[model samples]
Target: MDTILWIIAAIFVIAGVVTIVRGGLIYGIVLIVVGLLIGPGGVSVFS
Candidate 1:
């Protein structure tokens, strides 16, 4: 479960970075925030 959360968080963060690079500021920030919240090391919404 932790591993899965980590992978999902990583993907979200990476996608957020890519979105920011592509000129999406708000969406990217939201994605990053959500990623952090869902991460096992962070808030872990699932846990």
Candidate 2:
């Protein structure tokens, strides 16, 4: 479960970066925040 969350978080963060590069600054920041919140290393939503 932790591993899965890590992978999902990573994907979200990467997508966020790509989105930012694509000019969606607000959306990108949202995605990165969500990713961090969902990750076990941070404050996991599942918890």
Tens digits of lDDT, candidate 2, 1-47: 99999999999999999999999999999999999999999999999
In candidate 1, where is summed lDDT lowest over 10 consecutive residues? 38-47
Query: TM-scores for all candidates?
Result: 0.94, 0.96
In terms of TM-score, the best-performing candidate is: 2
TM match of model 2 to true structure: 0.96
Candidate 1 residues 1-47, lDDT tens each? 79989999999999999999999999999999999999999998887
| Residues forming the 10-long window of minimal summed lDDT in candidate 2 | 36-45
